[model samples]
Target chain A: DAGVTQSPTHLIKTRGQHVTLRCSPISGHKSVSWYQQVLGQGPQFIFQYYEKEERGRGNFPDRFSARQFPNYSSELNVNALLLGDSALYLCASSADSFSYNSPLHFGNGTRLTVT
Target chain B: QQQVKQSPQSLIVQKGGISIINCAYENTAFDYFPWYQQFPGKGPALLIAIRPDVSEKKEGRFTISFNKSAKQFSLHIMDSQPGDSATYFCAAEDDKIIFGKGTRLHILP
Candidate 1:
């Protein structure tokens, strides 16, 4: 089976601009989460969506937002991007929302470079 | 405060030797612990995982040792190889996952 897939493998944006990253979860998966990994750092959660509803959010600012489609695909939108926003955006998906043992499968990630 | 703290930003080990990485978490509620391995230009993939209920879990050459009382966990790679060189991240999951800063492991041939 195909793992999680993300679109526009790479992206470039300017300060104050906006960017949208897309993710398609594996078949039969109902939950997707977004994370940003900066150089030399671990991923920081941005948002999570399951069954078309917001399940959880991280400490990111309002500038970061996300939505899940009925098909379980997800999109992350970053508004007024800052240079600091340049990082690898990772998308991970799990089979269910509440399963304690649900292991997340991740996509290769979209590398965002904001100048 | 960082919810999870990982030590020794980087590690180097000779082939066939053992390489260990440590991490400690502050949230006692975190019952699930997992380790992820990532290569250059690729996202992290699950290496191994353990729950507080288990003291240690071994999958092939990788093992996760969990200390529930101390809220600390570690990963040990046995018979290290150049192929094992990558970045390793320790994570704790409660409602969601909190990841450590990550450790870069380089196994020399």
Candidate 2:
């Protein structure tokens, strides 16, 4: 079975620009989450969607938003990007959400570099 | 209180030696503690995890030692191999996961 897959492995954009990253979860998984990993730091949670509904949110700004599709794929969008936004955006999937025991499976992540 | 503090931002160990990384979490409400390993150009993969009710859990050469009263946990990699070289993260899970800053471990061949 294929693991979580993300698109546009590498992206470069300018400040004030907008970018969209995509993710396809593992088959039979119903939960998808997004995280931002700065260089030399661990991943920080951004948003989590379960059954296509927003189930959890992190401390990220309003400029960051995400939505899950019926097919269980997800898209993360960042608006008015800044140099601080440059980081690896990771997508994770699980069998379900709110179940603490459900381990997360992650994608290689999309490397976003804001110029 | 949401922070999970990890030590030794980086580590170097000889092959067949023991590599230990420690983490301290402030949130007692966190019911689960998990360790993840990530390689270059790849996402983190679950290594081992333990719940608050258990003091320790071991899988293969990896072990997680949890101290609830101390609010601390550590990952022990026995028989460390070069293949184990990567960034390791300690995480606390509630509805979502809170990850530590990460420890880069380089095992000498």
Best by lDDT: 2
Which regions in candidate 2 have their CA more than 4 angstroms from the true location? none
lDDT of 1 by residue, B27-93 (tens): 8988789899999999899888888999999999999999888889999999999999999999998
Residues A50-74, candidate 2: write the lDDT tens digits: 9999999999899999999999999
* TM-scores for the candidates: 0.98, 0.98
Evaluated at residue B102, the lDDT of candidate 2 is 95
Report i-RMS for every model: 1.5, 1.4
Please give the distance, in angstroms, between residue B11's alpha carbon in candidate 2 and its true position after superposition: 0.7
Give Cα-based local distance difference scores for all models: 0.93, 0.94
DockQ of 2: 0.81
lDDT of 2 by residue, B4-96 (tens): 999889999999999999999987789989999999999999999999999999999999999999999999999999999999999998777
Whole-model alpha-carbon lDDT for candidate 2: 0.94
lDDT score, residue B77, model 1? 94
Poorly placed runs, candidate 1 (over 4 Å): none
